[model samples]
Target: MIVMSVVGVTALAVGGGALLMTDNNASAAKETPAQQAAARAGMTVKCPDVATSLSNVPQQARPAVNNELAKMDSQVADAYQRLAEPGAKADQESVRTRVLDPLTSERRQTLDRIATEIEKVQPRPSGLDSLAACTVKQDQAAAADAQAAAPNTPAAGNTAPAAGAQGTGGQGTGAQGTGGQQQSGPQRADFVDIRKVKPNVKNPRVQGKGSKGTFSSRCGRNENKHFNSDNVIVAPGVSNGAHHMHDYVGNKKTDAFASNQVLESAGTTCTNGDRSTHYWPVLRLQDGTKEFDAGAPGGGTEGNVGRILRPTSVQLSFKGNPVSKVVEMPKFLRIITGDAKAFTNGTANANASWSCTGFENRQLKDKYPLCPKGSNVVRTFKFQSCWDGKNIDSANHRTHVAFARADGSCQQGFKAIPQLVQRITYKLAPGARNFAVDSFPEQLHKPVTDHGDFINVMSQKLMKQAVSCINSGRKCG
Candidate 1:
């Protein structure tokens, strides 16, 4: 009858999985009726005040902290959502293995990072105290989830478990009757939603290293003097003024108000003749010198303006809506990647898009970190490609395009298209070489504002070709 028991064998860890099912089941056999009742009815806890404590963090480190927090909250929230799945309640072990375990590890690292930054600036541990409390509450809930996932079994005695034991894999309790409810409403996300949350494990419908539809342009580059916002189109031809400055690549005639007609006719940066105008914020040196712009997108120049060049390759592929192929994307849709508003408006990083010497093995943070000598500094981008099947643009220019779930599936109601991930690299070997992306002066050369903007100007002919390549499962470059 005993359902829950306080693990007595190990030190209660915050994020790491606490105890094994063997330990719990071994003890559960002896639990009295009272213990079972308490176990069925999980403990009560209070929510942590994350914002008020974040105020104490250094202004410079706030974005990184905020970004990390969003990720953590998202981690837990995804688990809760899955907990509502059909089998989630029965197999707590499977749920813990796939979801909770990873969630705890990520939370641990995030808390440690927040703590480190807190110590760097302020003496009072306000942020740490609050975040720590939040983790503790989450940990308690996760433990209950694990316990609930464990099957009620008789004591197996004091027999020791083998090394690297993966646990009983039995049917136990889950987040259903244990983990507390978040909020009331159909729109409520079990976790925080600064942006949409992708699934934990993405099972690609079409999987491979080469299945892609690509368009290349050798058009020259253009580096504006400052961070330029192409908000003019969204703002109705405001002329050279938007959110921040941007460096346009591909199509020649690119301004906030430039239409598809203008873009199609403009000369392209692509030597191969693709006239697509691709652009992102410019990267400038911290010193604000002309030399740093050496490798930048040369507005009137061709081939590796200063330092920028047509990315070695521009890859496009379509991802199914978490399960099936995507339909055609409406023309003239405005898809914005990364956070431009964050750099200027003092809001949380929208995309928190980052870069590193090696995109696979990440190390940099909110800003672009200076890579060591003899390294290929890579600029990475993850665009919002999934469509809501309706609006081309939202009030924030983001809500319209849904993000892929943890498993790389488009959120419900969103049709998945090619989640275009443009990873560009620069050959800047170690030393005092000149290379940096233009960022807010306070941003300190970090790659936070490194967002991308693309207008779908593909004529019906070209669009049809792209659709064929994707739907037919061919790699067209």
Candidate 2:
């Protein structure tokens, strides 16, 4: 076997044998039982070779672009190597900072560079294009590799798992592309296939003339990484903060231990007489500023990290039951939508709705549309108001509260409560560019972790008034 240095890494014989990777401080450490027992499966992490594809690029751009890709690939390999090492951080915090965040950033930077370089090519490639064509190639290869893992694929907690290894320790869950089945864990299942996610809402039960109303909240940019308050709702105030921070809208004070009593007494950012407790992750500006998001370095959430998409409109409305009667929502009812556990492993369960002030027709994904002068970036959220006569909260963070099926009828055993819809808009001064949503560092700004939480804390009078708005079909401000 012969050796040569290519871009600081060595090349070895063309056979499947021990590959020697040398570094100034390299040492050969023997394997330990703990390390061997970590992962249920294994995978190879390396940058895809773009040399063969470079032949299609102009000679002038080939060398420069190839170098750029090589750098990206090297970064990926290094990340994988570190993640695979024995005793790597298997916990959620460690995985995000050590694996997800760095990898997400690296992937983002690489794709951005590839996009820049691809623009320089005389004959641009078409189809399978976003940032760089290589992304798709790499993902496809990864998917194949994941599918080929043996023995149930071991939940990716070990095996240097990037196969959606955002902490699928016991479930045998692999990452999305790795063909892993993520069940609302660190990585959520995919966004239910964009095709199935049709924008055309069905059954159109948006009834009642005055039930329509609007309200706004400036949840602020995600200033701190404490938004959702991990495991707080079920257990009053344990951590008392989320892996990220949130902008409080309706409630004047919302914290980890906030109770239904406190929320009712709290003031709201909205001027409308309605006083429901509404909150969501804050929106952020893209200025290269780093914070400790769940997926970001110094992040703290177990199931954290992902793109924080700019919301187009935070539309608000009310819903009623089959009887068309306005019923006050039970006090202390807590409802949460969207998965916070959505990390970059393609387990994002996102139904993010984004749009422009005037360009309402243009709903976008992955990329936030740049608003023209004077227009605002909008974000909207609708909550499920109908509740099962039994539980206020569920183990999955959902299901206890149910959404009205297309017919405007609550399923059997569920009672309809006055549900409020919120839509917010952000006017980014004038000529705003490079604006990004606040997200877990590992989200890589992919716009998937968008979610909302609400607690029914309205006073009896306020609750009735709000419910009347929907039942009477009157729009309240």
Q: TM-scores across all candidates?
A: 0.47, 0.51
Candidate 1 residues lying further than 4 Å off, grouped into runs, are 1-230, 233-236, 242-244, 271-274, 286-288, 291-322, 343-349, 356-359, 363-365, 370-373, 431-435, 440-445
lDDT of 1 by residue, 19-100 (tens): 2233344354454432332232211111232432342345555545555554544444444333333322212344356545
TM-score of candidate 1 against the unseen true structure: 0.47
Best of the candidates, TM-score: 2
Query: Number of clashing pairs, model 2?
Result: 41
Determine the C-alpha RMSD for candidate 1 after optimal superposition of all C-alphas: 20.6
lDDT of each: 0.41, 0.44
- Model 1 scores a C-alpha lDDT of 0.41
Highest lDDT against the true fold, candidate: 2
